[model samples]
Target: MGGRGTRAVAAVSAAAAVLTGALAGCGPMDDIGLGQSGAADGGVGKGAALGVSPLKNPDGTGPGLAPITTSGDRAEARKLIDKVRTKGRGPKTGYSRDKFGYAWADSVDGVPWGRNGCDTRNDMLKRDGRKIEYREGSNCVVISMTIYDPYTGKTLDWTKQHAAKVQIDHLVPLSYSWQMGSSRWSESKRKQIANDPLNLLPVDGSTNASKGDAGPATWLPPQRSIRCSYAVRFAQVSLKYDLPVTTADKDAMLEQCT
Candidate 1:
């Protein structure tokens, strides 16, 4: 692994240790089934008590969205959110997933983990999963792992058979980005944002599905304590892409930190 990849793994390892300890203390919960794909937006549960704060993990190489608890950090989160430009969303007339390139393509450049010999999805899985077991004879294909879902504040032992339990979420949903000026962006730029680790999160699939195309104004992670961190991440992607969020969304982002 290269420096970025190493850093990503190291970051996740540290977070996984914390979550694993938490799980050990609480004991495993009953299998309540799993969702298909999604993040952030969901019902409340155990909080993601430990992980890299978005403020510290600006590159998105780190694991799990930790709660922004300090007032100073919240103020800083708000400052970043304030820098994001706000405007009305555009029409989604011509938008399709294809415009941003194929799902989990490793071909895109200018984003972390791109062209890193692993697809974006697996890169994410490796980044956020613990006790990961790769596919037979394959270093890049993850077959099993334990995922600490920051959105729902739960953890699960996941295998390839139940792959949908975890999802790689576009923090700024692709469709939401489309409406927020991504439609005017170059195809390559769109692909960069689409595959960018900074814009992605691995969380409960159903929670992620609940957040489809919705902005902070309408949807947020069920783990209330991490809302500020989530807002910071949303702003990070917006600023990086030069995409303006909606006025309502920006307001909501600011409110999360305050």
Candidate 2:
């Protein structure tokens, strides 16, 4: 990794350092700094640490988008979601994934895991999932893994055979981004957003397909319990790119944590 990828990693590291250990506590409130529940753990947990509270992993540098189960954490989630700007969606004309870059392209600049000889999809898989198995003699191609599907609140025994068993979701969907002024953005910026780890999640394939370019107003994770944190992740991606969701989408995002 170099350029933006390096900085993204560093920024995430800094943000995570203070809360990483605290996140291991029993409740969602402990994911952030809701209160002093107990003694701090030694350090960051492993990739097996799925269902990580989104409140503590603001940069999307951690694991699964865990549910905001506690009232305190839900309140914090709402606050984050509330900050996202709102606008009407724009035209989708001339929009295509290629405009951003190749699917999961590694060459995108200014994103975590970019230019690291691995595609964004596999990078996300390794980041949020565990029990990973890479292709023989190739570390970049993920052949299999067991992942927590936060959207459905289920664990999947995934393999490459049915690639759709798991998918890399763009928290801010590419088509949604196109409508939210990304259509006019430079190709580099588009590619950066497309590949940025902060905007990506390895999630349930069916749920991701169902979301298909829709914003929070029209779609949410199937596991209603995780909605607030999902909205927070959406807002984080939007704010990072200086993009705006539709007014309805913003409102719907607020509903999740309230």
Candidate 3:
């Protein structure tokens, strides 16, 4: 927590300053639950404060990915990106989703939100979503929530019925990881990277699908303001696992911070 951390914290703090107080008069808005009425009545407003900056949320446990504003934070982001090693991407011959363990297994040890009775998807839904509604009789199951999709800068009134509308994106896509040498990793290591909150983001599904296995070199969030933050998150995951990004991807990431 140096200059970079302090500045990023200040950015989030200033934006959140307006939201410090609770809802004043809980009249009709409280009837259908706070967030349940949001989508129907246009209650959930859009703003940059909907999330926390990657500069402060290195562990990715905070909330959504907030844009990284200010020259200082961008400079700091570039420094972090510079630390990631770069190499030519390998091959994708023997990779599969199963190779990283079943989707969102709570049983995976050593990662945040793991083995917490809820699966990783719901955990992320709870973590990034605001005004959450849970399925009846289950605290771990999320029925609906208001989410700010940083990838597209859209606020969604997401429900379980249309589960594919929002997807948890891997900042470093698993297939990309395979090409970057994850195929040579132990199953446990692969699972850690796959389930690690630091590498995951709840974003617009279509945007994420369009990303495929492409790195920063080829794909990025459509919201220009969030690109640097996205690049930083990518670097965080790479550094944490001692993984190497492709040279092109690393260069692209550095450019985002500028």
Error of 3 at 223 (Å): 0.5
Mark the regions of model 2 whose C-alpha exceeds 4 Å error after superposition: 1-49
Better of 1 and 2 by TM-score: 1
Please say which candidate is ahead in lDDT: 2 or 3: 3
Write one digit per residue (lDDT tens) for candidate 2, span 1-258: 789999999899977875675465543444332111121321223433445677787666666676778888888877777778888999999888889888988897777667988778877777765666779998667787777787888888888999988988888989989998998888999999988877887787777888899888888888888788888889888988999999999999988888
lDDT of 3 by residue, 6-85 (tens): 99999999766645432443333333322212322223223222567889888887677878889999999999999999
Best by TM-score: 3
RMSD of each: 12.5, 12.9, 11.2
lDDT of 1 by residue, 95-161 (tens): 9999999999999999987898999998887767766688889878988877788788898778889
TM-score for predicted model 2 compared with the true structure: 0.80
Determine the C-alpha RMSD for candidate 1 after optimal superposition of all C-alphas. 12.5
Q: Which candidate number maximizes lDDT?
A: 3
Steric clash pairs (candidate 2):
4-110
Clashes of 3: 0
